[model samples]
Target: MTTQNLLVELFVEELPPKALKKLGEAFAGALADQLRAQGLASEDSLVTAYASPRRLAAHVSHVWLKAADKAVQQKLMPVSVGLNTEGQATPALLKKLAALGADVSDPAAAVAALKRAPDGKAEALFYDSLVTGATLDTGLQKALDEAIRLLPIPKLMSYQLESDCELPGWSSVHFVRPAHGLVALHGSTVVPLKALGLTAGRSTQGHRFEAAVSPVVIEHADHYAETLARDGAVIAGFEARRAEIVSQLAEAAARLGGGVRAIEDEALLDEVTALVERPNVLVCEFEPQFLEVPQECLILTMKANQKYFPLLDAQGRLTHRFLVVSNIRPEDASAVVGGNERVVRPRLADAKFFFDQDRKKTLASRVEGLSRVVYHNKLGSQGERVERVRAIARAIAQPLGGEALAQAADTAAQLAKSDLLTDMVGEFPELQGIMGGYYARHDGLSEDIAFAIEDHYRPRFAGDALPRSAAGVVVALADKLETLVGMFGIGNLPSGDKDPFALRRHALGVIRMLIEKDLPLELDGLLAGAWPVFGERVVDAHTALADFIYDRLAGALREQGYSAQEVDAVLALRPQRLGQVARLLAAVRAFAALPESPALAAANKRIANILRKAGEVDPHVNPQLLQEPAEQNLYQAMQRFVPEANAQFEAGDYTASLQTLAALRGAVDAFFDDVMVNAEQLDLRLNRQGLLKSLHEAMNRVADLSRLAA
Candidate 1:
């Protein structure tokens, strides 16, 4: 048991944050695969990888000093495609394998040697059988080199433009950015590998601004991280980057009075990481005049245009002051502060002018303008959509109680896109929905109406929130439903993975809102009623696109802590009420853990098997054809249970209905046990099948129990 480790580092100019993160992960995976492929990674040692904007590194411990034994399996697809039962290569297999350069001759051909992987006998067969063998079993160093070569970098380019070559200068290797150098060490052992256009060395570069390209030598594999940090670069991984941002923002904001609060800017943080090797806090203030603009305008101008953070007062009011994270310490910081402030003034001024001008027109006045702003060619004008929304929202809202949420919803839906007519919102398209909400409130519309306008687009993404207010929920559902109906009407149904219109998101949005509010509206009928509104534009639901909405629900239920099977069970009952489906899923999980389901499943299976065998026949049984007492008793039990089960199902008590069916399981088991279902007499068999068919019919009214996998 000897000990050894290999460390490799790549130093490059800053790469884009997303590309860096992706490449980091991909490189790490590729490195592990390379190690295992070469037997350098085993149960005995570990292989790990890490990446940041400036560097990517991988470490393998107990790495074999010598290359491991290798046996390459090349394809012989054509030759093996129609191979015989005996160990012989088809002429095609021989031809293909020969073209593939496989040594198929002498003792045995490649296809001839291909055998059904013997059970537990050979590891190679299992590895080789994978789709495309999608695994590497080559030399460790070679595999690492190959993986780097194959890594996908967005916007890849050659650095050098000349030498009569259109081919760009690769990092002298394939990478999104230049690979300045490589550091390769083996537990302080230098594993020379420069031939791959990479150096085997113990040294690495420091911060691009302060430390420049100065290389610091590392003595050991574990010290690689610590040494980089000590060199004033927070390369301890992404956590270092995140921690720096939080602390710097807090410290920078504290000097002004309140701590800096993070804006809704996941994308900005990523870009910042790529732009800096070291992070330090910097705060600057602007003229108070900018604060008069909409907070979104103020915030967006800084984050999107200047990459700055707009400050907030203790009361959560936007202040003119802002923060910026910098890569270098400023001697006279005012230079940096003044530079950013100067750039933001023009952008903020444009926002203010738009806001002032937009307030001149009332939301009602802009209603006619929405007709020109087409929602979807199939969905009709936004004005027409507002009408449908008004109708749908009114029907859905009045029932939510004390909230007057419905009126608020109708008001909001009418004003939802009215901001599009505004000059400011036109320039800042991202502010479309938010500006509408702001304008409604500014124009003295109720808070509920304003909030509904804003929150209608809530939970826009998978994990996003659903509207909590009744009015918001109604409008959100109405807005989504109209879009769905209009899309379906015009033959724009999404097929396979293509959903250019985001109909899937709209469907999920409606379902999530209805479920959240416990609205008891029937979705199928709601969709059908909107037919007149959609007219010839109604798209058919023949594709899986309709069920795809349910798939979204199933996913949402899982996020709420229900297992996929439990969700499936609830949906199997065809429960249209999402809230009930949620409760039903909980019940199914509880019942599944009980001692009764297997017995019930078995009994349910018997009923299904009988019905399946009977195949599309009438459920009616001749009373005279039942020769056995058990058959009569089972039939009697099911007949008695049907009324209760039907009521439970109608009330969405799926579990209770399932329980009602379960109660008949004992009678069902007895009937099948005590009687020969395939009776010798033809009429008797029909009678028995009819009895089972009736049992199935009772169970299915509650759920499509036949679809339930045992």
Candidate 2:
């Protein structure tokens, strides 16, 4: 068998910039996977993916010209059914052999060739044959077809291909884009195949305008990338082009020499990389007076609208100059720079206009406008949602920080959604909470209130920061709680991977604040407080919503490196104060490490089963009813250790509490080994059950020890 490196490329119209990276990876991965599955490529084959604005390609090394032949054995039928008692093949056996393309000309010879093997209780006849392997041409065709079928194309386009015949007609073809050419080479030979109405060739177009050659010619499979770069004026690999863009951006920023750097956003970088073939970083600038608007507005406009990188100074203030990644490298470059600067001026001016007009009316004035803005069809207007949040925030703050904090929280919550009516926020919804803070400050509100209004939407996504002030924390909690409860109450719970309202994120935010802030409020109490705010708009879904929050918490804890068993044990108790969950998990981990942990856990499981079966056994045990020596010893051990464990638990030293309880493992094991929990006498059985129940309660103060049982 001969092996050679292979290269394949698809030349098409511009691809969607956001999906280019994943498209390239999926294309190459599926191609190589299909080849390996067909045995035309080995496991150690190196696969390199190339993607540009107009092309997707892959180079795979160590691909076989023809896979090696394999010996295969297949079951035919049971021996009793395939052969007669005369040791001759039956008509059914001959027919099966004929269908398998076996030598059926001589029935006796065919019968002799069959092997008998035991399959379960019966012996079966097996056929042995040599299966010919796939050739590169056929294998590559299948791989190409599969790769294209498996592409994660965001959307498909339908176009017509001109007919090759004399008849004037066209054929419709559907693909991500109107593909014009395909290059497939095994070593130096072009693999004969056709896809998307184009025959495989050794040449492809590159860098729509700047290519040194009209059509870049790939001389060999190994030379695809090098030849493309030298003749086509394009960087074929996605990561290579992205890295070049990064390096050029850094160099251009260094030339400014004020400790200035481009704002770091990976998504923007990737999208920009996908939009260009040969990246040439150019310095562009806008009027410095545009700086009057918030830097966030300028940054968002540049990155989101113009795809430009806004430079920031040492103090993290936006500079007048920005960097642009141009596809063409012109010598003078002044025209490119001027054109980009001119294009961004109107966008900046619009943001400034919206900012100026928005400040004329204070956030308090805009509060009335939110009544007209619909939040949810079932939940009424934003005005109604604002009142609910205010109520919840006040309830949360009253217990956490007394009356002053409650007043601050109420004020912040009242103005929080008011910005949704502002022109600036209306134009850029991402800046809803952000614009509120600016307008609040402009209205002569205190910094505390302004910051709270802004930070109320904190932790909008995973890894995002929480609120900075106590008032902000209250408002954020209230806002997320209102969403969770209201949505869950309306039976809009997240199903499968669908969470249109981001209910899962809201639940996680609530959990993070409760635990990370270590707020003294109970989880159930917070949910209860939020329910009444909705009044009759929502049904009683409190239990379901709490379960949802706890589930999110358990997942989060597991992601933070806690084992499933540890999370299960701690969460099993439904600890209302989520702040203590981390400590409970830590205690469980510590308890699980004890040498006596297994026996105690097993005994705890046994005791749980007994108590459950006993049905409502009291924890109180009359000392006189303790007849067994083991039972009396266990009671004495509990008297010494249970109080100490209870004291440690009360002090929030969960690890110490669990460790203290570990001291009774010996007595617990002895009691389970010697005494019967369900005795013949009713009094004795109830007393034994009561003793076990008391032990169960003490052991489970930190976490359910039974869950730790292996």
Candidate 3:
């Protein structure tokens, strides 16, 4: 067998910039996987993917010209069914051999060649055959077809190509983009194949306008990337081009020498990389007066609308100058720079105008407008939702900080959704809460209230920060709770991956605030408080929403490196105060490490089963009914250790509480080993069950130790 590097390329119109990275990876991975599955490539083969705005290509090393032959063993029918007792081949056996392309001319010889093996209770005859290897041409064709079929195209396009035959007609072809050329090479030889109405060739177009040659010609499979780069003026590899863009951006920023750097956004970087072939970083600037608006507005417009990276000072303030990644490198770059600057001025002016006009009416005045904005058909308008949040926030703050905190929370909640009616926020929905804060300050509201109004939507996504002030925390919790309770009440629960309302995110947000903020709030109590705000619009879904929150908490804990067993042990108790869950988990982990843990866990599990079967056994054990020595000793041990564990638990030392309870492992194990929990006498049985019941409660105060049982 001979091996050589292989290369394949598809030249087409521009692909979707956002999907190009994933599309390139999927194509190369699928192609290499198919080759290996067909035995045309080994496990040690190196696969390199190349993607640009107009092309997708792959280079694979150590691909075989023809796979090696393999021996295959196939099970035939049972010996009794294939052959008769007369030691002669039946018609069925001969027909099976013929279908397998075996030598059926000599039936006796064919029967002798079959091997008998025991399959279960019966013996079956097996046939052995040598499977021929697949040639590179056929293997590559199959691989190419599979790769194209497996592309994760966001959408497909249909186009027509002129008929190549004598008939004057056109044929419709569907693909991600219109395919213009296809190239497949093995070493220096072109591999013949056809895909998307295009034949394999050695030439592919490169950068649209800057290519040194008309169509870059790849002479060998190993020289594809180098040839394309040198003659086509394009960087073929996606990661390589992205890295070049990053380096150029840094070098250009360093030249300004003001401790200025480009805003870091990986998604913007990747999208920009996909849109260009040869990246040429250029410095562009808008008027400094545009900075009068919020830096967020300017940055969002530049990155989201213009695909530019706005420079920021060391203190994270936006500067007037920005960087643009142009696809072409012109000798006189002044035109490109000036053109981008001119294009961005209008966008900035629009944002400024919206911001300026939005401040004319205070947030209080806009509160009336939210009544016309629909939030959910079943949940009424944003105005109605605002009242629900205010009620919930007041209930939450009354217990945490008394009347002052309640007043602040109420004020913030009232104005929170008011910004949804503002022109600035109406134009950019991402800035709803932020614009509310700015306008609140302009309305002469206190910093605490303004911050709360802005920070009420904290932790909008995973790893996002929580509210800064106490009032902000209260308002954030209330807002998320109202949404969860209302949605779950109305039966709009998330199913599978279709979370249109992002209910899961809202649940996690509530859990994060409750636990991370260490608010002295109980989960059930919060749900109860939120339930009445919706009145009759929603049904009783308190239980369902609480379960949803706990499920999200368990998943988050596991993601933070807690094992499934550990999470299950602690969450099994449904601890209402989520702030204590982390401590409970720590205690469970500490208890699990004890030398006596396994035996105690097993004993605890046994006791649970015994008590469950006993049905409502009281925890009161009569000292006189303790006949067995083991039972009496266990009772005495509980008297000494149970109080100490209870005291530690009351003091919030969960780890100490669990460890103190671990002292009774010896007595617990002895009792389970020596005494019968269900005795023949009714009084004796109940007394023993009571003792075990008492022990169960003490052991599980922190976490259910039985879950730690192997």
Candidate 4:
């Protein structure tokens, strides 16, 4: 029953910075999960994960030294197989008992003790026993092995361990990195286990150069982080190290004193945190001439290539000075700052050179080079894709703004991918559309056209801003639709988590543009226009592509706080004008919350069923056939309310339209309750069906209210 806090650490060579956070979380989560599954750790146990550039560790509280004993019931063979006709134990039963490590001295007595339970049509014999709990040593070993096997390693490093760590011969081991040490502590005692050719010990190596002690001694399980920080001079926890770096970056940026701040990028911060153990943010600078080149180029080079955070001024302009997260905090610190500055100058110069050289050739001149660059083997060259995109863009633009916008969109789409041929775009592919815009401006093109080229790739990810100009909107929509239709046409749709082409993102981009821009374009018309651009290269994937877009839209609406029922009610119609979907959903939600919503929703569901079963009945209510008082009352209600609701619907007042129908709830409910829909007379039955059909049509204008029924 004794329990103790446990600590585990795997020290290794530097890990891939981008993947370190995931690796750390997965390692800690898998280890703790395995321990809990084995009953060695309780649900109340707390797990703290620590990860640095060189280590991944987990400290778990209240881990028992041994798991609790578990009761197990195992079904044996049928009674007929285990016992003879005379109710005596058979040889097979004795063999089975012997195999189970049970006493088989008297088979009859053993069989008599077995429980009888009915399994299907036959009675079966069952054996129950207490399973001894696993010892901590064995459980920890299994958990460690599983955790290591499950680490989200970006790439595995294979190496031979030192002879002393394993056998005398060169023993090959593959891991995220070559393991230098493994520390496993249960309280103050060392837990006997081995991983990656290293035995468990209290000593683990810390910061390579700044450690107070080369081999940090973790005195106890709970003392891991504090001890490492004090003796090893390393911030062992990933979040702790990141917070320290962020604080240091802010402090350093403040010293510059011109409303300057380090550029904020979570991914960049995480990567930099994973690159250093003891972060010491120091100020560094480059020549102001480098700033003359596009700030994006300088920023990208500094952050992506050098892992530096560029300081930005009050006007959002990149400052010459940047912050570097140095691993060692030397007293003077001059050498570290100078070294980083020197290292970064060449990277900046390269970017500037690429930018300058790229400007010499206009985007128009480079358009021909895209033919040499293949976009996709099956989809043809970038040149061909550009032509297709231009065709789609022009088609989209004509309806929105006549020939002026169409020409602008066509011009932008033609030059959008032309930047791919530029040296700057080749050096930094992230700046493709951006450099295209810059070069378009340099070519003396109109600002609108240049902006359209630049903004064509807007809203690349979720929550990103859409294109600002009419031309940009047209080009952006065309670009995304082409990717969606082309990819879906080839049957390369996203399955589960595997979307190589990012078709889901493209679909979402199209949906956002249509809905957010409130562009009068219909989804079916958009797809019909995009499909022909591919000609025979693509199959008729219009229907499939539209469905995929709707699926993404449904998910997006649900994420925006609509319940599944509410979203289903609205999206069930597959509304063509996605711009109105938000309005439709709002109306549906408003209608569902009303006092009369439940009754009306149920009646609408009943009416739908009745109409479906009636098989294509006209909604024209023949008043002469309305004999019952309930049917006649419903007829009068429809005549009085239907036209007003239709007027509200035509005026774009969906909420008012749906709310207006709530008045007929009484008549609708009474009609369903009192009238016989299937009367003996054919004319009466048809009339009743027609009245219900009319009600169904009016109730579902905004959404399929029946889908909201419980």
* Candidate 1 per-residue lDDT over residues 539-638, each given as its tens digit: 5652344466677787777888876666665676556666666666655665566666677666776677766766775788888777688988887887
For candidate 3, give the lDDT of residue 105: 95
Could you give candidate 4's per-residue lDDT for residues 20-125 as a string of tens digits?
9999999999999999999999899999999999999999999998898999988879999988999888888888878888888877679877999999999998
> What TM-score goes with each of the models?
0.80, 0.98, 0.98, 0.96
lDDT of 4 at 239: 98
lDDT of 2 at 456: 90
Please identify which of the two predictions, 1 or 4, would achieve the higher lDDT against the true structure: 4
Q: Per-residue lDDT tens digits of candidate 2, residues 127-234? A: 999999999999899999999999999999999998766888998988999999999999999999889989999989878888999789998999988888899999
lDDT per model vs. reference = 0.70, 0.93, 0.93, 0.90
Lowest lDDT 10-mer window, candidate 2? 162-171
Please identify model 3 stretches exceeding 4 Å from their true place: none
What lDDT is reached at residue 267 by model 1?
76
How far is each candidate from the true structure, as Cα RMSD in Å?
Answer: 6.3, 1.2, 1.2, 2.0
Of the pair 2 and 4, which is ahead by lDDT? 2
